[model samples]
Target: MKKRGSGILCHITSLPSPFGIGDFGAGAYEFADFLSEAKQSYWQILPLNPTNKRYFDSPFSSLSSCAGNTALISPQLLAAEGLLTQMEVEDHPHFPERRVDYPAVSRFKRQLFQRAHIRFQKGGVPEDYARFCRGNSMWLEDHALFTAISDHLGNLPLAEWPQELSNRSSEKVQLLREELWDEVEREKFLQYLFFKQWHLLKNYCNGKGIRIIGEFPMFMNYDAVDIWANPELFKVDEQKKPYLLAGSPADAFSAEGQLFNCAVYDWDGLRRNGFNWWIRRFHYLFRQYDFVRIDHFQGLTSCWEVPVGEQNGLRGNWQKVPTQEFFNTMLQHYPLFPVIAEDLGTIGADVRETMARYAIPGMKVILFGFQKEARERSYLPHLHPLNSVAYTGTHDTDTVTGWYQGAGDEERLELYRYLGRRVENGVNWELIRLALMSVAHTAVIQMQDVLGAGEESRMNRPGKAEGNWEWRIPTADLGEVASRLSEMTACYGRAQD
Candidate 1:
């Protein structure tokens, strides 16, 4: 992280695979090999948490902060472990090649997991599974039980469940635990497979000198296991419903501001407990990633809190938090904290001061540099600070080619003038070259940008809820892309060799 390097921003779900979605399978290994051949020092990915498809299927809005996504469990790996037969592995529906069919993938994987679980039950569980369960009992047990109960009750939110179950009173919890013990174990088995496969893939990448940059959202969804398991830690009413919601003030991206629909934290309660929960969370994430990117780092200094019933974030107020104390406590526990601050939105002096004091690298996006205002020059590569991570565009942004296509004539001309050229090469690669050659310590480009993809391959749209996080790369283009990226890495002195 201290050296000048570059990487690609591609989520695990974006990896090419024969299954409906990507997994910790051959696609993952092939990507690692491609990165190695390209001399890439890092492979940045979104959060690996299990996404709630019933929600928006956004990685940030996950069911559990600690649990891995079972959708990423490799069926081939399962066959290798003798839990699934070759025929079973080969017998799957024909999924779309360019996009993920989440619902279909969920159904297919769930049935396969059931078969694997039955086989494991008959053959006796492995000692490794027992050790993993014991080691992660702190969060795993509660998450497994919560998932089992949610399934049993037909996926109802905890608040809608029976009062005794919702409150998780000792007697009700014990009774349900006994009744749903098998279901809980089944959930645990799924997580065990996920981690087992993930570790193997991570080891493969690390062996190739590729470090993973994992994402961590600042706030938790109201329906997540974290809030459900620890209701006392959030701004909830007597009945455990949220009193205030998390969001941002009106910005260029949204006239009414973004309604995140996440629960605001009870800062006082968390401070009273010495922020041990966050400390544990960081411990888990650091073990899983070489560098953790704290999404919405500005929220740590202050947050925009809106009334729970508000239609939008226009009526929200900014409240300062105990940012310094929280970070200090976290550092006391884990001194060598390697983190990147996603300081993208409106930031105050205090936030900048905190990040500077901690020496944490902030972010610069080239897509934001073409604004009509001169004050926005910081996003330009020439103005980027040395201790920052630069990107052509983030997953939340349109692909470079897409942005160029959608831009007005004036904006396109301005972009060309800024680059001191007029479409000499593809806009995507031109922007990528700018990022790689910048003074920032690290540069990352989205996979779509590297492939010169257009709007059809866009990963997300900020205001839109559906039709996002579905983009996937085609397997046939990896070789050519790797060769081009390797040349670029060497030209910019970012090559590892």
Candidate 2:
């Protein structure tokens, strides 16, 4: 593992915002400045992709891995780019000022991106658009067509579509391509605009020495273009319904384990093709960011396979994975890229062994450390692997302040004992300091923990489907925390050493 540096785990949506969701505009520039001031090297975000109604609420549940979330786009940037005028963005519509009301934000932002797309289409293409489209053709064409068709599907399942269309028959697809060519072309142009703006934003962060850490979920949404296009990779029946699905076992979030209905990959088929699907996904993602964190990292070793139509993972069984082959293939192709193993919750020894063999760093969440076994046990920082990444808490876990507020006396005492101190006023900060001081190579503090905020700042609560991922931060500056964190990073030698 490389000598890790300090970073912050702030989902892009939680950055300073009044726009319901954060975007790669002024707020992003501001964050880059903060990261530079804080001497932090990384800004970790959840997946950046297009999503559906239920899942757009949680970035973890996105529709397409390749398509950028049209929602996170900044209208202000569109204006600055000559695609829109201030007259439009300022007076377009009134949106919620506090947490992200995604639906409303989506509607407003879509119209803006649409207008921007129109302007770009009518006008000649920019140099960046030419570069991005040329570079991303590996997935962009298919993804753009998928977006166009999905919207045309109008919430109808693929099975119900006309047979030719449903099967993606060559003749019908060719016809649809010709008929919907304008829409498809415009959609492709929209993605091009998104990538162009996103690249500019990324360059600003990189210039400030801020590297982004991004997450890639193992399974994608059923309505995604990937599944609709290549149902062969999944355990889907002829009708394209999933035979078996993905999820985790029962835990604090739910007595019934989560039943993520997305189909599990066909390991044999994946191997036959040399996991080309995964290769493209990783290749495209690496081109966009500094590091990729595989969510549910244990799934690569062994996944909890839930039977389709099952309400929960209660009856799911542990299924073996072609772990060695899957990872060995990726490592062969992209040996230089870094991957963080999100090894949390009921991990098996094989998972740890796999991570060690591959030199991939796993995670240690401090909030989970509140448990009896986590402290004075191997899960604690003292016993953690030097190649691991330590977090005060994660997006799904409660914020440290929220944890302290909700945990019982025994739990608090456990934390106190571990830290060798009585609980104090700023318990969250204390935990952050501990994480910074831990032996793990990388230390990441969540935005909520930095604010010492309570449950309200919590990004998601796992099992609770809706009302998660909607917690957007106010347009508050992070200057104070940035200065304080810089001092702490310097003190801990976590500054880019």
Candidate 3:
């Protein structure tokens, strides 16, 4: 990140695929090749953590932070590895080309996964599979048990389960584990497949000089395995329900406030435990990716804690944590903490100080630069600091063209004035150019913006519940701008070799 470089922000789910959702398959390698051709140095993606349909499959709200979304396991890759037959891989529904049908995809993949598991069982487990299970046992065993029990009980929440299992009584758990041995092993097998395919793709990207930048969400879903397995690490009540939820305090965004319904961390308990959970989580993430973006970075210093059952975010209070001690411990574990801070929202001075002290790069989304209150000069291209990562917009924001289309006259005039010229090359390209030319050492653009895609191509809408995270790129459109992007990258001194 020290040298001038540029990357694209496209999640795995957004990549083109015939499996209804992107995965670690041929399309991923093709995207890597495209990135290399376009002179990109980084391939940033959202959290690959396991997602559940209950939360509309949001990546941020995951079943296990240490686990990968099995839905991303490519059937094609499985067939190539001889686990799935070629005919079985090709036999599928007519999936939507531009959007993911999560439920449909889930149903389809579950069958394929079962078949693969059965085939593997018939052939006997390989040494590598055994090694993967053993190496990831810390989280793998508990997660598998949690998943197996949930399935056995018809997807009931942990709190609603029988007391013996819910409380994780060692005797009852061991008994249940024996009973659900097949189910537990199936879950572990799925993880093995997800990791095997993922590392292969990561290696391909690295071999092409493209570094993978993954994300780590600050909070965990209340129903996640982490909360159920490690109750002491969270602020859960007697019923195992979260006493406080994670969210933002009432401000300009909402008068009442927001409730994320996510579990809040027990900061004191974490510190007492030497932040072992967090250190392990980082170790898990760093092993797969070159860099990791710490989402909701301000939470490291202080978080807005809203009491559970609150109708709105009004009752939330800022709770501070041992920021210095936490990072100190993290540094002790990792001598080089390669992280990008998602300092997008209302961040405090303490958070900023910690980021600066640790030399962690913060984000500079150009979309926010034109907003009324956020028209800070630092957000402008000419004023971006060298230590920040510049972007046309993030996954949560609209595409560059979408924002430009909806911009008020005043905002448009302001943007034009900042550019000091007319909009000749499309607005998306103009912003992309701005990002590339900015003093920021790293510039990351959304794939949507690269094709001048509009609102329909936006990856996500923050407050809206559904119809988001469904956008996908077409294979043909990927190479359309390679030459132009490569030219601009070289012109801006961002091209590698």
How many clashes does each candidate structure show, in the order listed? 0, 0, 0
Assess the local accuracy of residue 89 in candidate 2 as a C-alpha lDDT between 0 and 100: 82
Predicted candidate 3 versus true structure: per-residue lDDT over 273-342, tens digit per residue = 8899999999999997999999889889999999877877778899998999999999999989999999
Please give, for residues 252-321, the per-residue lDDT of candidate 1 as tens digits: 5666777786888899988987897788898889889999999989889999999988888889998889
lDDT of 2 by residue, 110-198 (tens): 77777777787789877867787888787777777766776777757555556676575558777777877877887787777667778
Error of 1 at 1 (Å): 1.5
Off by over 4 Å in 2: 372-376
Query: 220, model 1: CA deviation in Å?
Result: 1.1
In Å, residue 429's CA in model 3 sits off its true spot by: 0.2
Q: Report residue 190 deviation for candidate 3 (angstroms).
A: 0.7
Better of 1 and 2 by TM-score: 1
- Each candidate's TM vs. the true structure? 0.97, 0.95, 0.97
lDDT score for residue 361 of model 2: 88
Q: Listing every candidate in turn, what is its Cα RMSD in Å to the true structure after a full C-alpha superposition?
A: 1.4, 1.9, 1.4
Who is ahead in lDDT, 2 or 3? 3
lDDT of model 1 at position 62 = 61
